[model samples]
Target chain A: MDKETQPPAASSHPRHHAVPPYLLAAMAACDGAWEAPESMREIISSQPTLDKADGPVSVTRTRIATRARQTMLLDQALLHERSTAHQKLTWLIEPTGRLNRIISDAQGVEITPGTLIRSEGQKPSADIDVNRAYDGLGHVYGFLADLFKRNSLDGSGLVLRGTVHYGEHYDNAFWDGTQMVMGDGDGEIFNSFTSSLSVIAHELGHGLLQYTTNLQYQGQSGALNESIADVFGALVEQFVAGDDAAHASWLIGKGLFTKAVTGVALRSMIEPGTAYNDSILGKDPQPATMAEYVKTTEDNGGVHLNSGIPNRAFALFAKALGGNAWETAGSLWFNVIATRTLPENADFATFAEQTLLQARRDHGAGSAVESALKQAWDTVGVVPRLKENDDE
Target chain B: MSESLRIRVVRSGGVAGISRRGILELPAQEPSGQQDPDWFTMAHQALNQLRSIQEPATAPAVRDAFTWSLNIDGEDHVVPDQLLVGPARTLAEHVITLRGSR
Candidate 1:
C-alpha cells in the first residue's frame, strides 16, 4: 500500500488521540455502550451547560459532544507533537563557565552560580558549587518544559538564574523574586539544598506560581501557594522517575536530612508522621487534619507548617484518582491556580470552593474530578459544599 | 576476640557558639550466642529519639548538647557534649574520620 494511501488501522490506537480505557469507560457510563456514536454525541453536547443551571439539557448534551470531538482533535495534535520527538538541545558554555552569550536558536539556557552583584549591603559569599546548582536547576527546567510545555518560570521563556553557597552554612533555599538561591546546608541536620531534585523543583515551582497566580505569601493563600509548589515539586520528581502515585515517595526532601538524623523523609505525602520521628525537628510538625492545625508565627506565619493540611489533601486526591499524579490531580490544581479569581488573602475554604468549581468546569460536575476533589478535601477535614453532610 | 564496629556520631550545623563533634565507639566483643542483627538500625532509632527532643529553632543550643549511641557487639555506648559545626557535610566527614580510627 502507498504510504499516505494506507487506511488507518482499525484496532490500532491513535498515538495522541487514543483515549485511556478508563476515560472511555467513564464516557460510556455517562451514556451507554462503549462505541455508541449517538450516546457519545449526547454526552459531548451536554458537557458545557452542565455547570450552568438554566441551560437546556439538550443544548448541554450537544456542547459536551462538540467538546469531546474538539478534545479528540487536540489529542491528535499532542500525539503528533510527541511523534516528532522534540530533540533534547542545549546552549554553548563560555570559558568563564557561563552561558552569558545566547547563541541563535539555543534550545536551553545555562544559569551560572553567582553572588548578588547588585545587592549593596552585606554581600554574601559567591563561592557557590556551580555543578550541583546547575544540575538542580536544569532538572526542574527540563521537567516544566517537557511535561507542561512551559518555556520557563513564565510561559514567555524567562531566563533561569541561580546563586549557590549564599551564606556561611546557610540552612535554607529560597527564590528571591528574580533568581533561585541555594545554601550549603550547615553539615549537620541538613545537607546542600541543591542535592535534592524535589527541593530544586519546589523552589522553581515558587517562581512558577509567582509568574502565574502570584499568590500572596501569607495566611491561607500563601499556604496554598506553598502547597502548590510542594505538590508540583513532588510531581516533577515522580514524573522524571516515571513513578505512579502509589509507587512514588511523597517526601519533599528525602536526601537532605543528614545520616545523623534518623528520619524516613522530610515530609510524607501519604502519611505526614512518617516523614520524621526525630525529637529535635519535633516529629515533622505537619498536621494532616484541620483539627490538628497549628496556629503559629514562625515560618512566614506558619506558611510551611499549615501547608501540610493542603499538601496532604492534594496527595490524597492524587492517590484516589490513581495513575500519574501530574496527569489528573496535578493538572486540576495547576488549572485552579492558573485561573484563580480571588485575591491573595483567600482562605482554605475559598480555595477549596474555587478548586471544586474549576474541577467541575474542567471535568464534568459529577465526574472523577468531583469525586477526587471531594475525597481529597474530606480526607483533610475541609469538606466541599456538595459533600459537607457526608463528612464526619 | 570479635571484630569491633566503631560507629561515630558527628554533629554539625547550628547557630554559632557550639562545639560540633562527637564519637561513639562500639566494641566488637559480645557475649557468645547473641547477635546484633543491624547495629545501624538501633543506633538510628536512638538518634531519631534524641533529635525529636531538640527544638528546631534552638538547634544551635541543642547542638551543644549533641549526643548519640552506637551498638557494637550488642552493647550501647552514648557519646556526649558533641559540637554542632557548619552543616551536615562537615559532620559526615567528621564521622568518616572517626570511622577511619585515625
Candidate 2:
C-alpha cells in the first residue's frame, strides 16, 4: 500500500540481516505467493521499491533462488544463535558504543515504561514529552559515553528506558530502580519535567550512582548521592552548552518553572538557597556550607537540603579549576566513585577524603587539583570526621 | 461540640527536592449521626492502617520519589511515596490539593 499504512519497521533489530533496500523490495514484488518468514516479510514490506513495477520474469527466477538460499540462515533458531553470538562479542568489546533508549507514555498514571511510544533510532514522537524524554536520554547518554567512557547508566549498555506523563499533576522525575519516570508538572509552579535537560540528567544520575558507589540514601551519604546527581546534571547541561566552569550558570532544573513562579530553578550550585524565593513555595532552604547544615528527620534527614553543602563545594572546586568542569573535577569525582571502596554510609567528610585520595592518585600528591579539592571541602567546612562506629 | 480530625502531610524529595506542607482539619463524628466527609472518613481509616504497619527504619531505596510525613491528630507516621497506598494515598492527596502549602 502506502508508506503511512505500512507497519513501523523494526530496522534496528540486530537479527535483521543487512539487505539492500531496493533489492529486498524487488525480490518481494517478484515472489507473488512465495511465503517468507514473519520478520522477513516485515523487512521486505518496509522497502520503498515494493510500490514500484514488478521486476522482469528472468529477475523473478533469480530472486526465488536467492531468497531460498537466504531462508536457510533465516530460521528462527539459527537467527537467535547468530544474534546471541553478536551480543556477547559486542558486550565484551564495546558496551557503551550504542544507544538503546525506550521512551513510553504513562497517560498521567504512576506506571513505568507505560506504553512504548518511541525507541532508539526512531523518528521523534508526536508528543513533546515523549520526544523530550527521548532526546534528553540521548543527551545524557552521549555526555557519559563521550566524557567519562561510561556504558549507559549501568556502564554495560543497559537500555535507557523512560516514561512520560506520569501521574496527575506530577511535578517531578525519578529513577524507580530500572527506568526513568518524567512528570507533566502541576504547571502552576513548574512546567513539564522533560523541559529541562539538567533535570533529565539528574534522574539518570541516580541510576549511575546506584550502579557505582551506591551511597546509602540517608543523612550525609544520601545528601552526597543527591549532590552528585546535581553535579552530573549541571555538568551534562554545561557540556551540552559548551559552557566552561566559569561560564556555566550552575543551576539545576533551570527553565523548569512557569512565569507565575518566582524562581529560576530547583537549586543553585554556585549559590545555594537562592534558587527560589516564592511566597507559595517558600524560599529555597539549601545551605552553602557545613555550618548551615540542616539537621532534620524529614526528607531522609534532609538529603535534598544538606546536599547544597556538597553541591556548593563541587561548584567551587569546578570554578577553581576554571575550565571544563567535566574534565578535571568531574573526572576526579567519577574516579572516586568508580573505585567502589567508599562506604555506603560515607559521610561528607569521608567522601571528601576519598575525592582527595583520588585526586592525589590522578594528579600528583601536591598537584593543584588536590589543593583545589581540599580548598573546596574546606570552604564548605567539611573536615574529615570519624563516624561514630569508626571511633570505636 | 463537633469532633474534628486534623491531617498534616509534609511531602518531600522528588527531583526538585522541595518540601511542601499541607495541613487540614475536617469535621468528624457528627453528633447528629450525619456521615463524615470523605476526607475525614478516609483519614480515620488511613490512620488506623498506617498505625498497623511497622514504620520503615531506612530511607526508601527509590531515588527522587517523594517521602511523606503524615501526622494525624498528634501521631506521626512517615511513609515513602512508593509504599503509600489505599486510603492513606487518597487522604494525603486530598489534603495536599486542599491546602497547597508553601
All candidates: DockQ: 0.02, 0.58
Candidate 1 error regions (>4 Å): A1-129, A385-392, B1-102
CAPRI-wise, candidate 1 is incorrect
Chain B TM-score against the true chain B, candidate 2 = 0.78
Fnat across every predicted model, in order: 0.00, 0.67
Q: Estimate candidate 2's alpha-carbon lDDT, on a 0 to 1 scale.
A: 0.77
Instruction: Kindly list the per-residue Cα lDDT of model 2 for residues B13-100, writing each as its tens digit.
Output: 8888888788887655554235445565677789898988765676445798998989998899988887799999888877776654
Report the number of backbone clashes for model 2: 0
User: Model 2 clash pairs?
Assistant: none
Q: What is candidate 1's lDDT per residue for A47-115, written digit by digit as tens?
A: 432222334454333333333322432333254366445222111000012122111111111222443
lDDT values, one for every candidate: 0.55, 0.77
In the range A1-392, model 2's lDDT, one tens digit per residue, is: 34333222222224334544334434433434223333344555665544334545544443342342232222222334465655543332133346899999999898877999999999988899999889889999898777665567765678899999999989889988888899999989989999999999998899988887788889999999999999989999999999999999999999999999899999999999999999888899999999999999988899999999999999999999999999889977876665454777999989988787667556666899889888989998999543342210
Residue A118 deviation, candidate 2, in Å? 0.2
- What is candidate 1's CA lDDT for residue A353? 80
TM-score of each: 0.56, 0.78
Q: Model 1: how far is A133 from its true place, Å? A: 2.2
Best by TM-score: 2
What 10-residue stretch in candidate 2 chain A is worst by lDDT? A4-13
